[model samples]
Target: MTLRSRLPELDDATMSAEQRRVLDDILSGPRGNLDGPFLAWVHSPQLADHAQRLGAFCRYHTSLPLRLTELAILTTAAWWKSQAEWQIHAPIALKAGLSESVVEALREGRQPTFERSDEVIVHRLASVLYQHRRVDQATYDRAVEAFGEEAVVELVGVLGYYALVAMTLNVFEVRRGDEPLPFDEP
Candidate 1:
């Protein structure tokens, strides 16, 4: 079942007019909020609170730009073969200006596409971290060279966390409301 379709409706106190407006603003596109499960899943008060907090943290503190964070999110989702997660993030990825080549590379698991420094860095570092679990000195040095030690750490952390989120959402069957699988339903 899809997330919004599965989740029960919240109490009237759970969603304010302002909150609904914010949700509408964030969704602002086709099929983005076509179901209650998705609306409830995303609008759950706790998650909304956490998202607000996470946004502030990421905006102010992370070494990764929002685009870079989105890259890590979408790539990890693709790597995990989580269609729901991928569909959710694809527009965010494009909105961040990641080129078609980069998106294809993430889908195809092709790293270092076009040899641009950041793409190479994110792809390679994410790949090695995904594959190796622990970055060896060589990989670490290269990643640090590409985006400093802090970014490398944050990138891995973000990728790992998003991978976990993707798995949880899939395993728990928390799909966006009306978000049928782009491929077959897993």
Candidate 2:
């Protein structure tokens, strides 16, 4: 679908070349998609900042390995039913080391029963932070102690960003490719 038809909700047409390239890539749908609404929203100035900050935060913060970080991100997306996020990230998450079973549980909106102790800790820890905005003393102390203060701060920051992104995707009714994710795909 052309950008005009698929996303009539879009009120603007002036896309930066960089933005246009990204949009075209998303639309091409080779890997998966976040086809229309999300593309449209990110074209906006405000959401663009949020998107950029998230990328930087993910790379620089979080002592939870990229694998664990992706798991946290995927679980947040799934919990919020943010298809745009899940679309863009599921394959990336798999590549980063989230297993099929954990992805499925996340996609199905359940607390994933992760096999690894560290995965379980991150999942449970992230869940509490997102759901409550505060962690209990022990969990907080443990994570901060395990990851150190800076890393823990970064983890919370990264998770917070994704949580906000999920909210936007849901609010704007973003649609990726028509098909749901093959969470089990290798």
By TM-score, the best candidate is: 2
TM-score of each: 0.67, 0.72
Candidate 1, residue 133: lDDT: 79
> Cα deviation of 117 in candidate 2 (Å)?
2.2
Error of 1 at 67 (Å): 2.8
Superposed model 1: Cα runs more than 4 Å off? 1-9, 13-52, 55-61, 108-112, 179-186
Give each model's clash number: 6, 0
- lDDT for residue 14 in candidate 2, whole number 0-100: 58
Give the alpha-carbon lDDT of every model.
0.63, 0.66
C-alpha lDDT of candidate 1 relative to the true structure: 0.63
Per-residue alpha-carbon lDDT of model 1 for 33-61, expressed as tens digits?
52322343355545644544443354336
Q: What is the lDDT of candidate 2?
A: 0.66
